[model samples]
Target: MYVYDEFDRAFLAERVAEFRDQVARRLSGALSEDEFKPLRLMNGVYLQLHAYMLRVAIPYGTLSSDQLRRLAYVARTYDRGYGHFTTRQNIQFNWIKLEDLPDAMAALAEVGVHGIQTSGNCIRNVTTDQWAGATPQEFDDPRIWAEILRQYSTLHPEFTYLPRKFKIAITAAPKDRAATKVHDVGLRLHRNEAGELGFEVLVGGGLGRTPFVGKSVRAFLPARHLLSYIEAIMRVYNQYGRRDNIYKARIKILVHEIGAEAFAKAVEAEWEAIRDGALHLSDEIIADIRSRFLYPDFQPRADQPAALATALEDPAFAAWHRNSVHPHKVPGHAIVTVSLKAIGAPPGDATADQMEVVAALADDFGWREIRVGHEQNLCLPNVAQEDLPAIWRRLEAAGLATPNVNHISDIIACPGLDYCALANARAIPVAQEIAKRFADLERSRTIGRLHVNISGCINACGHHHVGHIGILGVEKNGQEFYQITLGGRADEHAQLGTLLGPAVSYEQVPGLIEDVVDTYIELRAGPDELFIDTVARLGVEPFKERVYAAH
Candidate 1:
């Protein structure tokens, strides 16, 4: 966690004051709805279908106990008693009143959290692996670089308003937990043949009405020149990215229009001119950034805790451990992922009390650190293995311990017609029905490591394009219909899904998903093969045939 300095505090205060004045003017009729749109968007406020929504940025999904508590307070006081954690690892309060926004902003600023750059065509929250510093297989912590990039790009004069919103993701691990390939700019930190660290940069990756897996622009960008190289890419996009149509404004569209090779050539030419400019990251600056990040203190202990063996005797504890617990860099320490997707509840929402419970657990057992994963989950990145049983019990009591991390029931769904004004249909109820359909833990585990993502429209806020099973809601002839896609995944080998067939009625979606799962089971080599692998091995034909036939 990077603590805010005097300058950071001062900047947040000024922004809050400015926004307060803006809101007052809007209420006083000095600014109309159209006039206040951009100003409110710049402050991360959106006028949704029902009311105003405020999205707060959780940089790289990292938060301290104090910050978490402050978020809990904001949720309790300003809006409803809960907040939705989004796919981009940010939190949104759906019921926020426009008049109370300045108070909320000032309260969040006290803990170094704000919603700036969370909306309007600018660089959004920079995200990375939630387990960045604690994971064993990473080359180095990516959050250090994520924080550096955040400071460099926040309110940058040149990129304040791009043709469209841009996103950047970085990961140091070979296993891409950050969904790097589907971002506007994705960076993977890897060592070259000569053992020098550098980035493998991917440009033009995005999902929306048009989906694309990014193309590799630079096979090796030295770590020292990260900012300069990214600046070059931004310059190229700013210069040529379309502004005429909102649908074609994204950098992904620009890269698609001109070939990727041509885009790379243009970026390289820009890089050649500015690669050694003041934007270059120096050793001292990198070190300073690294030093600001808080790290856990690990103690020597047994590889496997003795109590863990006893805890496994309890089937509930065993299930949670198998699904939610992940390996950590330090021995006798584990990373605990808390699933917010409980049974039929809205995915990624945490009640104010639940937030406090997680914060309390982090303070007591997790070295006072918490992380929000892009999967709509919370993580205690450094929990002692011996304390696993106690943590599980606590989580269970709080309704935060759903042992379906990667299973079928752990769905990713956007706030469709329930919240968003742009949505054509409701997504939350669709996700809820599917979750209820697969509520049996044993049956879900049998289905195995499946991702089900739903979006109300083509905006793709739920990341429906990259799920193993994607559901897109559409309005056809005054009726709600859902389109299904298969075999998409967001990882090192990222690819967009293939549509199975024409859209089906909303009532047919759950049964359709069940038919697809049953088809995978019948066609899979064995229980060892995942749904995604089976879909990859056999194309979408088998599942598509079964699903349509069943329908």
Candidate 2:
């Protein structure tokens, strides 16, 4: 967690003051809805179906105990006693009143969090691996560069109003937990053949009406040249990216129109012009940023043996340990994922009390730090293995200990017609229905590593494009119908899913999904073969045939 410096605090104060004035003007009728649209959007406020939705950025998905408490307070006092964690590693308060937004902003600023650049057609939140510093296989902490990009892109005059919204993600681990391949710009930190740390840059990766796995623009870029190289990419996009149609405005469209080679050439020409500019980070600046991300004090202990012993005796704890707990870089420590996907609950909704409970747990056992995963789960990143049982008990009491990480029940779904104005059908209920269908923990585990993602529309906010089994809500004739996709994955071998078949009525979704799952189970070589691996091996035809057979 990078603490805000004086410059950062001062900047936030001024920005909040400016937003407060704007919000007051809008409420007082000094500015009409048309006039206030962009202004409110710049502050991460959206006029949703029923009320205003305030999206607060959790930069790179990191949160301190104090910040988590403040968020819980916001959920308690301002909105409906809960907030929805989103796929972009942000949180949304759906019942925000137009007038109370400034107060909410002030409270967020008090905790060094804000909603700036969260909603606009500008550089949005810079995200990275949730286990950035703690992942053992990482080349370096990708958050260092993610934070650097945040500082550089925030309110940058050159990129404040891009042709369309841009998203950037970085990942240092060999496994792409950050979904880097589906971002506008993806940076993979790696050691080159020369054993020097640098980046493998990918551009034009995005999902919407058009989905693309971004192309490799730079095979290797030196670490020090990150900012300058990114600037070059932005310059190319800003100058040539379409402005006539919103559909064609994203950098991905530009890259698609002009081939990847030409796009890379354009970026290279721009990079050559500004390679030695002020944006290049010096050794001292890089070291200072790296120093801010100090590793937590981890005690040396032999607790894993005890943990294993406990797991052997208790099936309940064993199930949780198997699904929710992840290996940490430090021995005798683990990363415990606090699942938000309890049965019948909206995928990412966490009540204020639950948030507080998580905050307290983090304070007591997790180095007072928390992380929001891209899968809409909270993580206690530095929990000692010796303390897993105690932490699991508390989380279990709080209803946060759902042992369904990567299970079929651990679904990712967006606030569809329930909250989002752009949605066509209900996503939450579909997710809820499916979750209840697979609520049997034993059954879900037996199914093995199935990811179900739902989005109300083509915006793909739920990241449905990358799920092993993706459900997309759409309007067909006058009825709500759901479309399914298979084999999509967001990892080192990222690929968009193939559509299974025709859209099925909402009532048919759960059964249809079961059919697909049954097909996978029957076709799979063994129980150990994941749904994705089975789909990859057999292709989508078998699943599609079974899902559409009755229809």
Candidate 3:
């Protein structure tokens, strides 16, 4: 975790005070709703269908226990008893009172947290792999660069008001857990033949009404030139990105229109102009940034404890271990994903009580640290293998241990028509119903790694374009209907899903999903074949035929 310095504290204080005054003005009628819109958005506040929503940034998805406790306090005191963790690894409070906005910001500031850049037509939160530091396969920690970007872009005058919201994601691992392909700018940290670290930069990737998998603009950019090259990309976007229509404003549109080759050429010219400029990161600066991040002290343990092996005898424990547990870089350690998507519950939501329980878990079993994953789950990144049973018991009791990571029920759904004014259909009920349809734990496991992402609209907030089974809510003849897509994935081999058939009524969704899964089961080579693998082997035609045949 990166601790806030004195400068960070002062900046947050100033920003909070500024927003406080703005909020007061709006409440006092000095500022009208239209006048307050951008101001509120800049501060991460949104006026949703029912109430004000506040999105707080969890940069790179890392949180100390104290920070987690502060978030829990805010959820308990300011809004509803729970908050929604988003696909981008940030958290949202859907029922924030307008007047309490400043107070909430001030409270969050006390723990080096804020809602800055969470919304608006600016560079949003810089996200990275949730398993950044702990994952074994990573070449280096991507959080270091994410933090560097955070500092550089926080209030960068040049990019403060881009044509549209800009997102950048980085991953050090070979596995694209960060969904780099779907970001405005995706940086993959890897080495060239010489074994020197650098980034494989991708641009023009995004999802909305129009979706694009980012194209590689640079095969190998030296790590030291990261900032300059990124600035070059930003400069290109700011210079030529559309400003006439919001729909065509994103960099992806520009990249698509101009073509990746021309975009790369323009970016290259800009990079040549500033590659050695002030933005160039030096070795000392990189080291300084690295020092700011906290790393856990690990004791040398060559093997897992005997208790862990014994605990595997319990069927429930064994199931959880198989599903929730992941490999860690440290010996005798594991990364445990606490599934927020319990069957029949809204995905990514955690009650204040559950938040506190997770905080306690971080303190007791984990290294007093927690990570918010892109999959809308909480991660204990530094848990000892010996303590898995104890952690599992606690999580199970808290209703946090569903053992459904990467499974059908571990859905990613947005706050659709239920909360968003922009939504066309209700996503929560459909997601809930679908989860209920597959409530059997063993059945879900047998079904295997199926990512069902749902969005209320075409904004793609739930990342529906990249789910194994994507359900997008649409309005037809003034009725809620869903358009389904199959075979989409957000991993290293990221690809947009193919549309199955015509939009189906909300009542047909759960059954449609069930039919698709059944079709996969019937067609798959074996139980070990993943849903994605099966979809790749045989395209969406098979699943589409089965789903629409019944519908």
lDDT of 1 by residue, 269-344 (tens): 9999999999888899999898887777678978777899999999999999999999988999999999999999
The true-versus-predicted C-alpha distance at residue 52 of model 2, in Å, is 0.5
Q: How many clashes would you count in candidate 2?
A: 0
Q: For model 2, how does the per-residue alpha-carbon lDDT over 1-551 read when each residue is reduced to its tens digit? A: 77778887787888999999998898899999999999989989999999999999999999999999999999999999999999899999999898888898899898899999998889999988888888788999888999899889999999999999999999998899999999999999999899989999999999888989999999999999999999999999999999999989999899999999999999999999899889889999998887877568988967586766765478888889888888888888888899999999999999999999999998899888999988999999898888888898899999999898889989999999999999988999999999999999879978999999999998889889999999898998868998899999988899999999888889999999988988888999999999999999989998877768856
Candidate 1: how many backbone clashes? Answer: 0
| Per-residue alpha-carbon lDDT of candidate 3 for residues 143-254, written as tens digits (9 for 90 to 100) | 9999999999998999999999999999999999999999999999999999999999999899989999999999999999999999999999999999999999999999
Clashes of each: 0, 0, 0
lDDT of each: 0.93, 0.91, 0.93
TM-scores, all models, native as reference: 0.99, 0.98, 0.99
Q: Which stretches of candidate 1 lie over 4 Å from their true place?
A: none
Error of 3 at 548 (Å): 1.8
